[model samples]
Target chain A: MSLSISLAINGQPLDVALDDPRVTLLDLLRERLFLTGTKKGCDRGQCGACTVLVDGRRINSCLALAASLDRAEITTIEGLAEGETLHPVQAAFIAHDGFQCGYCTPGQIMSAVGLILEGHAGDDPERVRELMSGNICRCAAYKGITEAVLEAQKAIADKSGAEQNRRDAA
Target chain B: MNRFDYVRPASVAEAVAAGSEPGSAFLGAGTNLLDLMKVGVARPGRVIDVTRLPGLDRIEWLPDGGVRIGAMVRNSDLAYDERFSRSFPAVAEALLSGASAQLRNAATVGGNLMQHTRCAYFHDLASACNRRVPGSGCDALEGENRLHAVLGWSEHCIATHPSDFCVPLVALDAVVEVEGPHGAREIAIDRLHALPGATPEQETALAPGELIVALRLPADAAAFSRNARYLKLRERTSYAFAVVSAAAMLEVEGGTILRARVALGGVAAKPWRAPEAEAALEGAAPTAQAFAKAAGLALAEAQPSGDNAFKIELARRIVARALTLASEGTPAAMPALPASPFSTKIGANHVA
Candidate 1:
């Protein structure tokens, strides 16, 4: 039997054709849809390399079956940038030098984005470490990862304030 | 992996019927099942995904002030839910202690409860595992029993329940609600797992066609031990199996133990509740001597292996320390795995 699902990906409505029930959302992205930015260091959930957002929640795409996400909205690493400008989180990673080999960069960015959007990321390093402990880096760049998230927090705060001031003026 | 039929039922009845078939598995989180499938530990012909079932994704408060956690509720959501933190702090703490944020986001409550053992012998296809194949024999018996079970182990199997959530759930007296061909039936949390006495093949009590709907827990003052703590002694800090974990629920009324429930992890085949230890502490005054004695009673039945003799001693110290902290109304100072995890450093400042 075939299953059809309507998904909202990157703010665009998509009707994806999925054939294999065992093929995970990670497979659907890299193998089927050519959204190869989401790296698959480990197809298992241990490595947070396949991070993505489903209905605004961060998940390991490697662990998520595409067939189960019927009408959910998804956001991928490729979808982080709007038009040509990078999302604040992505830019923060770049500005803070969050990665060495950059294989884990996308997953890190996606996870950070989810944390920021969910309002779980705080100024405390331990909180960030505890929350971001799932994504493993081969280079062992946790200090950079923490700094990157902190830098993003600052950027997000600044942007919110600027927007609030604009609203006040209006 | 191999191809399989997938069904996402919007209701409980449809899921129960689909799951009761000959070769099908309930897919909640898909974190463990799908990974195990890829590695060939689990190979189901059909997967009935119950995540979309309308009523199964909620956390409803029972009229008695207890809560029924839906099977499909995500672990991340449960860990962060304000209501859970207010009523069941230990439950939320245990959930957060298990996996990372992203993994927890994908892991469902039911799947975490039903996770298979972390024994390497069981997972590797090449090895002879009683779990993977019924009569192939347990390779861990004669092999590396370091991380294997010492308590509640039989000749047929030696493995530990890997989930961090079940320990707190079991101590809280949770009830597992299931739906099958006959209808729905509620099971005590203690009965969900069976000792691997003769049949290591049968891990959980869920029958062929049964689907877990939700877990209902009763309010117990012991489970809300503000002094309650989750101690996971793993090889690494994050995303590792428990080496010798303990969940302590201690209650002291005027310096005497009114009630206390001590449960151990990574030492037994299931989320082991220590009745002998609990009995020992019932009337004893809350002190170091009493706590250590209770720990000794709890570990009296432990049958450790050559590689893990330290675990027994370490287990005693951990249990004692956890009890003492909980009794004194102090937050448990999370025990760190010895600086030399793979060595014989084997002491946590407090003598075992």
Candidate 2:
């Protein structure tokens, strides 16, 4: 049965006519919508290659049925940046050389963003590593990934803090 | 994935009505069900989406001080809820220890309880799995069965339950509430998962078309919040299933153990509760020797189903270690890697 579902993909509202309930969010984004930035390494939930934020929470898009997420605010890798400016996590990945083959970089970066937003890990490298364990880099670039997450989190935190300080002064 | 009729029910009664169909299955986040469908292990003709069901997402604190967690409550939300975690630290730890952060964020409490076993044979379509096909023989009996069940096993099925959340819930005497065509009923967490006896196919106690509405933890269950711990041992430091895990909750006072709740995971088809172990700890001093004795009682009936005899010993040690950690007291803040053996503050010397 064809189903009409509305979603905010990358902050853009889209009314998708899903032909089949079997089409996962990963497939809907990659196949139908042409948002292939979200990789599908393992369609199973085991690998976090399809990590995306639905309502500001990180989840494996491959396992989620597209038909079930009506009106959900979804943020994909393509939605991370504002115009030419790269997201801090995306920039930090480049600065820290957090990827070798770059297959898992998008997922790693997206998961890092979600982790930073969750604010559970703080500045602890160990906690960051543990939290980021979901996004696996077969390239074995964990050291740089961990380093980039710490740096990006600090930068994001500082930027927000400065904004708060400016607001206080005003 | 096989094509199916999609349903979006707005209310619990409507959901139950739609879910009562012969080939209908309730969809909660689809973290596990979708994977099963992709793997061809589960092929339901009708997929009833229950995510939109009303009033099924709140964590209600009863006047009796017990907690009634809505079945649709996301695992991560429950784990991170400050009051919920503080009241049930071990449950929070167990929830954190499961799957991945992404999975926890998407998976629901009801879905976690309803997740199938991760036995390789069960997923392999070529392999004969009695659980998947009732009359079919079990390939796990003679195949590579290193991580198969040790406590509860018939020649029919040797699979073990793959849940961390259930281990602690069973120990703390959690109850499951369900709504069905026949009306509403409750099932104790321990009795929810049936052992793979003559019928491994009947995995749960739920009748066909029954929908789990909520899970409740008794008011007194929070009494052991100060000294409850879940300890999991696996191949990897994080993001892996347990080889042998244990949840230990102790009510200790004046250097003596007043009460204890013990449960084991990755050892049986169900979260195996050891009432004898809890009995052994009562009135005994909280010591390594006492913990060891209780651990021994916990695994007394344990015997190897295959090459996994090591798991029996590992399960015993994990129970002792978990008890030792619980006796020491829960940490003020959750460890970086919840429930991992390496994450605890206690050193190797302290492990009994």
Compare the candidates by lDDT and give the number of the best one: 2
Candidate 1 displacement at residue B59 in angstroms: 1.2
lDDT by residue (tens digit), candidate 1, A36-81: 9999988878889999999998999998898889788989988878
Q: How accurate is candidate 1 locally (lDDT)?
A: 0.79
Candidate 1: how close is chain B to the reference, as a TM-score?
0.91
TM-score of chain B of each: 0.91, 0.97
Best by TM-score: 2
Predicted structure 1: clash tally: 1
Q: For residues B245-315, what per-residue lDDT tens digits would candidate 1 score against the true structure?
A: 77677776777777778887778778888889989988888888988998898899888743777888888
Can you write out model 2's per-residue Cα lDDT over B128-171, one digit (the tens) per residue?
A: 99999998999998999999899988899999999999999999
How does residue B290 of candidate 1 score in lDDT?
87
> After aligning candidate 2 to the native by TM-score, how far in Å is the CA of B51 from where it should be?
0.8
